[model samples]
Target: MDLATDLELDHLVGRARRLVVPGRRRILGIVGPPGAGKSTLAGALVARLDGEAVLVPMDGFHLAGAELRRLGRAERKGAPDTFDAAGYAALLGRLRSPEPGTVVYAPDFDRSLEEAVAGSIAIDPSVPLVVTEGNYLLHDEGAWQQVRDLLDEVWYLHIDDDERVARLIERHVRHGKARPHAERWVRESDEVNARLVATTRRRADLVITGALTG
Candidate 1:
């Protein structure tokens, strides 16, 4: 499972706990390339935080499949331009400081349907932490540039290219793509985005290694 060491996991848990203030909300952004396990790590962190935290993934902001086809961007579905980057940033801003007694709903990406389901995650006002994981949180261009400033801290996940690539291909296959097609998508689409994500690594508050499977 490539589980993180006890000390590493403990430190992450501790850092997440410290982010929780009694009366204020904090957002933690986890960034990684395709198949680097951003969602898995974010889910683990939120689970450890008990009921004090909730996960609102950035994948929720992916442009609808039909919209992508209309824009002639279906072939580049995982690329930066295929997402509603501005809307994601705006959502984060709202989640960062929501109005009192307000309940905010966040979108969720459905892998099987390959669509974003709106209002899937509800963040109550009493929750003190929001864990958002995605590929572009550290990106410095276009609408994504505003994401960093909105996050309390952003952690970058690093994995060997071969491992990450394998994971991407497998995920695609599991989601109903043919094996050969999955390989092509990983090579042509995912790897291109992975290189872009790598460039933003230095901007992260921390770099996590060898925790991709956990």
Candidate 2:
């Protein structure tokens, strides 16, 4: 059976800190379905880790809006294919064995523009830990299958189903979608991806549930 623990933010932070190795970089991946607080928890861990960690979210790998449109995949933007999965895996490889004196720059997803902003995050090679969070880190299909082999540790976040759906809708609305449209997208699009992620829950090194701090 998979180990499921409800750890507080403090305990989680301490746990994350322990994963670091002297003179080597360790990557901790936080993965869950959309609206599962992956980013929130990731950011909290990074802030608490102080200078020891940097966050390089997988959302940064999203294909450009024009690319998605050109490929006629604009509707299901959060699906696995909407991202550059091979590129993400390659970048993870680079993160896993970071070279000395070379800073790895990562992109960030801009909610306001619904696009990826390049070189928005700088990962110093000396930082002991990299906390990456996203929906498909444990996904074992196609190009995403290689993700599991690269990360040092993986944590799966769990939340109430209703709460997760509600949060997704609220997030869409906050990002400028109409309430009805947001609800439809959550029901039709996001939930479909959520089910896919659920299948990979048992693959995580740890399963985290409960109210998160920070």
lDDT of 1: 0.90
lDDT of 2 by residue, 1-214 (tens): 5678885898899899998777898999999999999999999999998889999999999999999999999989999999999999999999999899999999999999999999999999899899999999999999999999999889999999999899999999999999999999998899999999999999999999976864
Clashes of each: 0, 0
Each prediction's whole-model lDDT (CA): 0.90, 0.93
Positional deviation of 120 in candidate 2, in angstroms? 0.9
- Ten contiguous residues minimizing lDDT sum, candidate 1: 1-10
User: How far off is model 2, as Cα RMSD?
Assistant: 1.0
lDDT top scorer: 2
How would you encode candidate 1's per-residue C-alpha lDDT over 1-214 as one tens digit per residue?
Answer: 1232322566788888999997899999989899998888888889989999999999999999999999999999989999999999999999988889899999999998999999999999899999999999989889999999999998888888898899999999999999999999999999999999999888888888875332
